[model samples]
Target chain A: MDRKAGFLFLSALYITFFGLPAASLAAENICHQQGLEIRQAEIRATPPNAPVTGGYLHIHNHGTSMQRLTAASADFSGHTEIHQMILEAGVMKMSPLKDGIEIAAGGHIQLKPGGLHIMFMQLKQPLAPSDMHQATLTFDKCGDVPVLFKVTKTPGQSDSAGHSTGHTHQH
Target chain B: MKKIIIIAALFIVTLIGAYSLSEYIARQLYPQNTGARMQLGSPFNLTAHTGEAITEQAFQGTPSAVFFGFTHCPEVCPTTLNDLTNLRDEVTAGKKTFNIFFITVDPARDTVAALRDYIPYFGDGITGITGEEEAVYALARAWGIFWEKNNITESGYNIDHTATVFLLDDKGYFKGTIDYHESRDIALKKLERLTAIR
Candidate 1:
């Protein structure tokens, strides 16, 4: 083929394959919110008819000012709340935080197993293994970031990319 | 044609005989402790996370990993659960198969709902079981679990119990126990070996 024709074909392919989808994703704002960027988001699987599940992720503050994560929401649960694992007198207890989780300016906070996390309660149904679900994380500043969570039999079972759905933390 | 037919028939007979002999040898070598062996091929009858009656019988015919713990347990219980979670992940990554059960000795406090909230914090395939104090005591004793509740100076209490994970075969017979102190990789290797032993 001639150079001009080849260039036109390549440009068409790029527009069809990459540009269109990128534009749509940008319009949906599935990755970034107001000023905060969600780095890695994951959810751990729960057994059949379980009432609750755990969600983990990392939040990075790209803005100059610190921001507080007030709450989170997902279609998978009736309610979502921020919780912290605290050691009180040798007991590891998980308590819901009334105040939102805070991320320092230019810093990052990790929501992992045995640490701070998002509690998904009142599950409508059991999260079966091999099922993938979407959760929308709402920040006090970032508004909302849509994340995809893959439900596996165990936590931290995702591929090296670190994208997963459900509560997965290691001891 | 007649010779071929006869050979095929002999091959089928040999296959059946070998299977039966292997089964007999396995039984002889693993001579089950009848008194210690839980009801074979029966589902577990325990309490659910909601405090209702749950029958292991409901989940029959699947190899399951079981552990005994309490909700008030601070370190060991959660640590073991997390370990089990890690083990489960490893097994899945290797395409292995198994189920898990978390039986609570603190029946008074670890109701079905409380377990419902607590157990799933670690992983998904784990089931939490609780029951009447007497039933729990009997089950623990039958499984050779020794646990004692010690009251602290403050308000709470702690249970010092055996930290071992019991493995049940698909037939619901007790296979073995994975000790608590073992490393995760070692425990997973043992579990994989146990499951691979047909």
Candidate 2:
């Protein structure tokens, strides 16, 4: 076989053995709501007795217009809000985003630990690890986007997408 | 040019000599700066998560890492506690005794039972402390921790608090601190130094 054809054959073989499995594995975590794409959606696993936890995800606006996530709800939580955590002058301050998080046209945003995240309170049941919990995210224009957030012990544990913010100590 | 370089070197040497002399005298005057034990924080009467009365004495006999936060805290508190658990394990490795103290800033909501339910997610070797609001705040003050309640909602309120984790020696003397979201490597090094202090 010619070098170019041989390279194509090897590339196909490599993709079959490596790329397919990863894509299929993460397929369950990725969700699509019309023009919006959500990836790496997960809820932090907390103690069975704990009443609160946090959820994280990445939202990409694949369409030509902007989208705003106004609210989120889960069957296991009585109260859910989009909250932002910021470190101001050595103080850790958390505030709810009542106006919601806005994603620009053709842009993306992350809701990760130590930054913006979904605050789940009054939990009816604990988020056990590896368990998938159903949640509905309400957007100003997109209506309701249903997602299944997999419970994880640590950030990026199930996927290699490292946290874009937080978890750093500058000495 | 050689003479100029020699003169510059001599000036730096003289500066170093003067600084060393001042540091020596200061250490002589204050023995605590020279490896002498210095206690920190005041005695406190509080309740542990185990539903038992605890005092500052519990912090003695073992090096401890203390943090102040409430159970209602969504991200910072739990994230810090989780990081502490992993860093402590890496530092201690079951070779020595190192305790972690989780002091609640919002005592009104963080009862003994509340802490018990919340702290278990970070694993063992953690002692949760909660009591009357005034008493808890007093203890936090003694340790140089500041907190304020804000954004009151119908459900509850949020607390703005210092996110530094205090490190103390076996004698309960202040050693150092690990800032919130501080790099894990530096935090691990601080814990190692604290554990080695005994």
Top candidate (DockQ): 2
lDDT of 2 by residue, A13-93 (tens): 999898765553344234243467777888888764557788998888887888899999999998888999888777888
- By summed lDDT, which 10 consecutive residues of candidate 1 chain B come out lowest? B34-43
lDDT of 2 by residue, B93-118 (tens): 75865899999998888888788777
**TM-score result, candidate 2:** 0.76
Listed in order, each prediction's TM-score against the native is 0.48, 0.76
Which model scores highest in lDDT? Answer: 2
What would the per-residue lDDT of candidate 1 be over residues B87-143, giving only the tens digit for each residue? 777877767667888888778877776788787777787888777777777777776
Give the lDDT of residue B149 in candidate 2.
86
The residue ranges of model 1 lying beyond 4 angstroms of the native Cα positions read A1-35, A87-90, A157-171, B1-82, B85-101, B105-129, B133-198
Computed on C-alphas against the true complex, the DockQ of each candidate is 0.02, 0.35
At residue B97, candidate 1 shows an lDDT of 64
